[model samples]
Target: MRRVIIIVLVLLPLAVLAVWIGVRAHRLRPKSAIPAGTSATAPGPQLPSPSSCGAAGRSQLEHYDRSTVYDWLDGGAAPYLDHGFTTSTVATYRFETGGRTLTIEAAAVRFASPRGAAAQAAAETPPGAAPVPGLPGAHSTRDVLVWCRGRDMLRLVSFTPGAETSGPFAALARAWLGGTAP
Candidate 1:
């Protein structure tokens, strides 16, 4: 009986640790922002094609609606949800510049009205971000750009720090905005 108790004491902790790890991994697993029964290729807002923005290949777009925005934005979804966010489309593009490839993530959020988009943009703009040249309602920093066009608010972020102000970043933003006519 003593030997059995000792064995149980040793194995119990290992079993508990295994279960903990499993629970943690289940929580951390990527959640699908797309709603069930909806096709991923469902028609929606048009983002600039990767090739048009000088990217190596096409981008795979993921969409999120008001119900599932948190799966994509996590804690950052609150402000968007509060501001009448309707839908959002996100994509990642790889651009080769100066012999180095950079990954840029872009998200286009549509609101119920132009007012909602403007409000969200203004709320997200930092104190000293410079206005993007020739793009009304657009602001930029070293690694991020936020812009609003009519009922849509578009954001671009560079995974590699300090690449936000690069030429490729601006070109991609411009291409997207040009294609997204009000």
Candidate 2:
């Protein structure tokens, strides 16, 4: 009976540990970035392909709905949520320039209306942002460019200083905006 009890005690903890590991693995598994009921290849506004912008590589697209926006934006999700955000798609692109690699992050967020998009863009615009040429409702700073069209807003950000003026930035923005026809 004592041997059986010892075996039970050891087996219980092992079982518990196995269950814990399973739970952790489940939580860590990658969730489908595409929204439910939507085909992965559905025709829609998509992030610009790397080849379209001369990017060396591009990350997989990630889509976030209202419920999961926080997973991507955390505290910054509040403004978007308040502005009737519908969905957001994000990706990163890498470009080789001047013997260095630059990473530009891009996001396309859709709102309930054009008014909401303009409001959100206005809220994010800094005092000194200059309007981007040929792209109405678009502005660019030293490292960030933001634009709104209809009910969609697109932002391209670069951490590399002064990357906003690089070839990749312009190409990517142009390619992305070109694909976002009203």
Candidate 2 error regions (>4 Å): 1-45, 164-166, 180-182
Report model 2's TM-score to 2 decimal places: 0.72
Question: Which 10 consecutive positions of candidate 2 have the poorest summed lDDT?
Answer: 35-44
Instruction: Give the range of the ten consecutive residues with the poorest summed lDDT in model 1.
Output: 34-43
The Cα local distance difference test for each model comes to: 0.79, 0.79
- Candidate 1 off by > 4 Å: 1-39, 180-182
List, residue by residue over 1-182, the lDDT tens digit for candidate 1.
Answer: 99999999999999999999999999898667644422365455567887667777546788788777787778888988888898877888888888777888888889988999999999877778898777776888878888889998888888788654457667777888778521
- TM-scores, one per candidate: 0.72, 0.72
Model 1, residue 23: distance off in Å is 32
Which candidate has the top score in lDDT? 2
Q: Write the per-residue lDDT of candidate 2 for residues 1-182, one digit (tens) a residue.
A: 99999999999999999999999999898677654422233233468888887888988777777777787788999999999998877888898887888988988889999999999988887779888776766888878888888898888888688654546667887888778431
* lDDT of model 1 at position 33: 62
